[model samples]
Target chain A: MAKLDASGFLIDLDGTVFRGQELIDGAAEAIHTLQSLGKSVVFLSNRGNLSRAMCRKKLLGAGIRTDERSIVLSSSVTASFLKKHYPLSKVWVLGEKGLTDELALAGVAMAQKPQAADWLVISLHETVTYEDLNLAFKAASSGARIIATNRDRSFPNEGGHAMDVAGMIGAIEASAGAKTELVIGKPSWLMAEAACKALGLPPGECAIIGDSLESDIAMGRLYGMKSVLVLTGSAKLGEPRLYEPDIVLGSIKDLTELAKEGILL
Target chain B: MAKLDASGFLIDLDGTVFRGQELIDGAAEAIHTLQSLGKSVVFLSNRGNLSRAMCRKKLLGAGIRTDERSIVLSSSVTASFLKKHYPLSKVWVLGEKGLTDELALAGVAMAQKPQAADWLVISLHETVTYEDLNLAFKAASSGARIIATNRDRSFPNEGGHAMDVAGMIGAIEASAGAKTELVIGKPSWLMAEAACKALGLPPGECAIIGDSLESDIAMGRLYGMKSVLVLTGSAKLGEPRLYEPDIVLGSIKDLTELAKEGILL
Candidate 1:
């Protein structure tokens, strides 16, 4: 196969760059090399708990120097999507401050109760209460449109794994007998489109590098971009490939070498 | 078709006898008349939040006189099932005080942490926290057996509908990538067996009456009992019957007339 000469790069955060608070070995150097080569790099994350500024700070702490503008989050994408579609709708949120803050900044009116809202936004929050879930259920049952940031079942954490928004979403859907209208995250074309717009490049010239095939690679494939699977996160070495990516690497550290060999020129 | 000629009655509470706090028309009279006819009346409920004593009290409040001994609850069945099968197991509970009280009375040791438990028991608890769900997820991912009290997605309440234990169970299952090992409630053979034991009759002579075809009618069909679907609750008039029951009625109020016709003799 010919070498993959990609000018734009979209990368996943949690499993690709680091796991929990520890940085994956050689990830930062690979990013630095990519930047030195003039590749447009955008760090993407499905985690909606942290703002773009907070995410940039965390990236800096891990020796990968990136600014807020280079970071794209699901929360931002969701807010933008809602603003474009339902600009004047009242939204009820079951998420953290980052998500609500983004929605608020987008000028979306927040509903105090589910019944008062036109849309219900669900995300992962460690402190989510039963009443919050019940409210979401009631609202959805009452015909409120439900939207989710992502559908990740679990994510890498300091402790083995932590429940992700998918679990909560499943619960709400089961109780309400309704499915979410939109999920503005990896594997969804909306998120891929947003990232592509941010990079100022067409999907054909960009490559998505991440650990999860179900999200990162799947999103890239759906958007007609080069999908690169890294082994630093969710996908295992021998697991069946549900969605075939353009390339596979043992870790993000190999990206520089692959570039040197003209494999990722 | 001949009459039902059922000698023992296994009735559902929430939808059949009462809707929220108000008694369903003719429900109390039907139960009283059944008792007057010397029929064995056992009230079966999938609600595990309340103890048998508490459930009996609620039945009394609805003008139905029933003793604690005549009530078979999912919590009590779960407690008995665990005691009989896993006598020396340490259990971690994600339920209300009623479930915990029942497990404690059955002499099951309660684990403080998920890691310390041999089994994880999940049910509906309005106050369940993310921490509780994470603990259950961790335990189940670590090979702990996951057992649920019931799997009702939503139950009838003062409001349109309230989220039931199914939501919690789905969340845990999605996070843990494991299905429940046992569900000791409606639609499950375990609960039907327990109810039959309480009525001191075989499944052949017992009739299961309730508002939900998914649970009550399904459970009866599973145990070779006469399934009677009542239209006062979850099941609607034209909904698809996944499992065909023996009989269908507009409401439990017609049970007396059916008895007079020897349909439920």
Candidate 2:
């Protein structure tokens, strides 16, 4: 089966491997199994507000046994895309500390003034202010290119789903009469390209497993990866399907059952 | 002749009446002439961030004698609409002092906490904060009905167009995945009704003169009132027409010219 013969796998972090502080059943064991079988694995996280380092630590705490290098964060992908494509441009960022920290660590040049920015990177900021929005508006009106990390309205937060970065983008675009030039996050080619490069595999040689039909499963469908859906997170059964997966299981624990059926090495 | 035959006039404030501390040409003399001719004149302002009292005082300073009773502000229309449709509901307002002050003056019950709000009134707030948006999100998720004053992305400011209430609405809608229930502003039936009542005139007996075809002229078309386009503001010559007007003029001062043509008493 195409689903069983992948050399590399891009796995979603949140909801798939763990939920908040608790690990999903068989997630760690499945990763260990895949690694032992000589399959390359990369944890792909869609949350831009968290750096790869933080996600790695969180995964490690949950017994996922993954390093930072093996984790591909949306923010890190954004940083790399900027560094490679717009190396000479100065960016004005609107994000939380984690996203800014990742960009800083990646050595991206930041603009001191919004009006002087060559690019305005819009991301989630919990304490976003009118001043921040006004500055971004100024940057947009002054001809700065806009790029957003993710357009998801909300994400699962400790106290329920919190508003995401799209709010920040909506404000700037509304004021300046401009549209975002790029979006580097799940279900987009930019994100898919990043995950493939991290695992050193072509799209046809990789399988993706996650709990979200919109983001994770859609990514698999768009990038031509073998997709598997698990019932441990935000996805519900038969919820207005946008993308169909090759397999659906009770949990990652059932993945080991596939090998018993001679579906894998 | 339909433009000149109106017994009442709904005049747009900013680009048509005045622009940033300066009166448009013939605005003062035209209003005085219209008043002398026994025509009911109401200055209809779309800017919700300013109270009726503030607009009246500004008009009086520009040698255009007008009372707060004759000025219809969008915020006041929203306040009236809420008080009429949902008298017992507790409203949580996201606006500047002028809007809240007007709502308070109108005796609308205000909700102290966003979560406790029964209706969330979204308007323009220059110093909007993350806490405000989060609270709005909380209120929306708690099942509060949402109503916006205006959805104009921006309005003409001293430096340029300043962002309007749409940004705040965009944020709350994005988070809650809900659409605004009502928008009480220009081109909306609520605003038209309010303006018509203020002038004690029927839709056919009233004419709206303004710089924006999308807003002022559209209101006339929707409500069956005479619509006059002025070259003095946001509108331009042949700017991809949405609403066609009965006549176009250089300024409101040219209103008397219609009388010279024997079109009115």
Candidate 3:
């Protein structure tokens, strides 16, 4: 089969380019190679702990030059999607400062407390407490729409791995007897759409590169993009057979070779 | 407050005396302290992966001395409990060899996989597969009585951990759109009654000591047993306030002192 032409690149962060501030050896070079070939690139991350500005700072700090327009974070996408779908909804957030700020920027009103909420957005919160859990349970059980940011149970941390929003949401869902109606992050179609919109290209005209099968490859498959599994991060040397992406490479260093191969017809 | 009368100790293993192979630091000393006070102590674990002999061997190896008579694995209790409640019932189990053997010993016939099963018993299995998940889901959705050994997501491993039967059952329950009717492990009144019956003591007369507030302390609270929280395992320092156990101690070293003070009334 001939390689499909793609207009842009949609990349994932944690398991793709870098894991907790350590950039994959050749990932940045791949993006530069794509840019030099006249292709747009946008990075998407499900981590809601940091703002988009902070993400750009970190990426650039890791030697990968990035600007505000070159990224779309899950927090931003989720907020925008929720605003578009449920305009002026009274939303309750079980998340951090980034999530709250993003929702406000999207023109969504934050519910004062659980009892005053019409919808519930479950996300990762560093200051998660029992009172927050109790309030979330109340809101969810009272029939609030439960929207999760992602289903990733854990993520890389500076010191040690930590339970992400998925773990917290799992406990809340169990207690409230409600399932998340929508997930708006990596592995979700919404995050891909956000990236495509940023690049002014259709999802079908993009290539997704990441190191994890369940998230990056799965997202690429869902969005009709060419998926490249890289071994620099979460994808181990012998684990690519499980997802079966369109391309398997050692690192982003091979992007020039892929471009030269005329696969992007 | 006056010292409370205590009959014997009923312990839960998973997050209590030990997590996986290593015993809680003071768990062995706690048992020795209880034994020196002439209080009978029995080890109980909800893990259905091993037989009674295996459980005994493992506990002994971990410094918590136990004989077959001094231990109660959930599989054996489940088999006996099912036989007592539903004589001639065809039981379907998604578990290991130990579970099947225990049911056989109870004179209960194993039902036809999932198609003809009357009840579903979920237990920990090292060999959990997609086929097993499908079978469990089918049986649960087909109006079978759903019962689980416990509600723990992951079992403690030597270093990290592995997803346990509880997580597997949670997935099945999610797909079936129904929660299990009963959890037969510690903190549940069913298994607590069985332990009380074996000790030939009234529920109010028995006492439980373990490291988990949700399971062990909750069991004691549910069955009217004096609950003692020991910090040799899963329960951290501030966990007791959430469950409110009757007695809170850092370790089992205080058992002899309490007994001498006529706490075992």
Candidate 4:
């Protein structure tokens, strides 16, 4: 594929900038170099369990330069999309209080009963119970459209790893036998569209850098964006070559090297 | 269908006893009434998230006479069936600890990684994560046999309802566009077979009673067991009449009344 004249960066977390609690090698320095070149960048993560503030705090704590607006968690994007597409709809939430709060802030009504809900939003909720899940299913089964944040399986937790919202969404899909209306995270073109809209740029004027082939590269392919696969996170050592990323490097260390050589700019 | 010499009682919970938090009028009394006839009765629920212990707790709390052993949750039946069929195999549990513990107690090994597993058992798990769901899709996509618990779209909780395991399984089916291996709970005939095996009785010697036409009456029809539709829970006053059940009653109370009137033995 021919390269487009992209001037902005849409970066993935987890494997691209950090893995678990540790920062990926040269991630902070490479991001700084990208900024010095006057490129607009947004840190996007499919982890919707945490709010944008929490995500920004985590990134800053890991020496990443980011602000609340510069960070877009999957939940935030989904909430924004719902607000734009279906304002005032009663939603049955299968997500955490953050999602519920976001929907509320977006002026959407939360329905107490599934049968009365106008729509369903499936997200990560730590306190989600069987009752909540059933309500979501019932609402969706009764013709309410479903909107999901991401399809990520699991993410790094303080302890090993925890099941992310995708699992919860999966359970609901199995029961309801319905597909979600939209997915506003990696592997879905909607994520790229959201990022482009947020940055005031077109899809062709952006690059997505991440560690997972299925998420980052697949998303790039879907949205016509350049994909840079980094090796410092979730991917196997040979996964970059196996998956055929446009640019396969050891880590952000190579990105900095490319910047120093003026090849990236 | 001719009435057979079936004598045992297999009752369904959720739709049978209550809807949401309100107990169907006379549902509790119906259980007591069935016991008064010295009949062997077991409450079978398709909700997979709750363990039999939890089911016992929920039912007893709802004023229903239920014990852990007499209540067969979908997870238990699924795990038990796997154990009986595959004595030595590693199972990738896409559910909660209850399912994991049950499979462990049944002498089945747990496969943490998807590639190491041969079979995928999809059930209701409160702790289900995106990782678990991804593994299920990947495993099933790679030709692993998929065994789901039930196809119930929604499950009743103390408050109202939650998504049943079938909902999540539906998502996997959508992604992979494949059918599941088996569903072992009500309406599938597998539940009837399990009941028959446990009681050492043939299908002709059993009678199925519940509040739903799809799960209860369908199983009865599939297994050639006499089905009695009770309208005290999920169904309306005349919903069961639409399915052509052998008998339709207002509740188990009606069953007891018929027995008292010497109309039923």
Question: Clashing pairs in model 3?
Answer: none
Task: Give the CAPRI rating of model 2.
Answer: acceptable
Better of 1 and 3 by DockQ: 1
Q: What's the true lDDT of residue B115 in model 2?
A: 77
Error of 3 at B263 (Å): 33
Best by lDDT: 1
lDDT values for all models? 0.85, 0.84, 0.74, 0.73
- iRMS per model, in Å, is 1.1, 1.7, 11.9, 5.0
lDDT per residue (tens digit) for residues A140-214 in model 3: 767898887776655566733444676557645665667888888777777887888889998788888887888
DockQ value of candidate 4: 0.32
lDDT of 2 by residue, A20-105 (tens): 77788888888888888889999997788788888888888877777777888778888888888888889888777778877888
For candidate 1, give the lDDT of residue B79: 91
* Highest-scoring model, DockQ: 1
TM-score: model 4 vs. ground truth: 0.73
**RMSD of each predicted structure:** 4.4, 4.5, 14.3, 5.6
Model 4 docking category: acceptable
Evaluated on chain A only, model 2 obtains a TM-score of 0.92
lDDT of 4 by residue, B1-265 (tens): 2332346778887667766656776777767876777767778877665677777777788777756667666778888888888877677767777677667666777776765677888787655454556667666665667887776666656545566666667646655455788987777666777766655568887888888887888888888888888776666763434456787777766765676675555
Which is superior by TM-score, 1 or 4?
1
* Model 3 per-residue lDDT tens digits across residues B150-177: 6665555652444556555654565555
Q: What is the TM-score of chain A alone in each candidate?
A: 0.94, 0.92, 0.89, 0.86
Q: Give fnat, all candidates.
A: 0.72, 0.51, 0.00, 0.44
Chain B TM-score of every predicted model: 0.93, 0.94, 0.85, 0.83
Winner by lDDT between candidate 4 and candidate 2: 2
TM-score: which candidate is best? 1
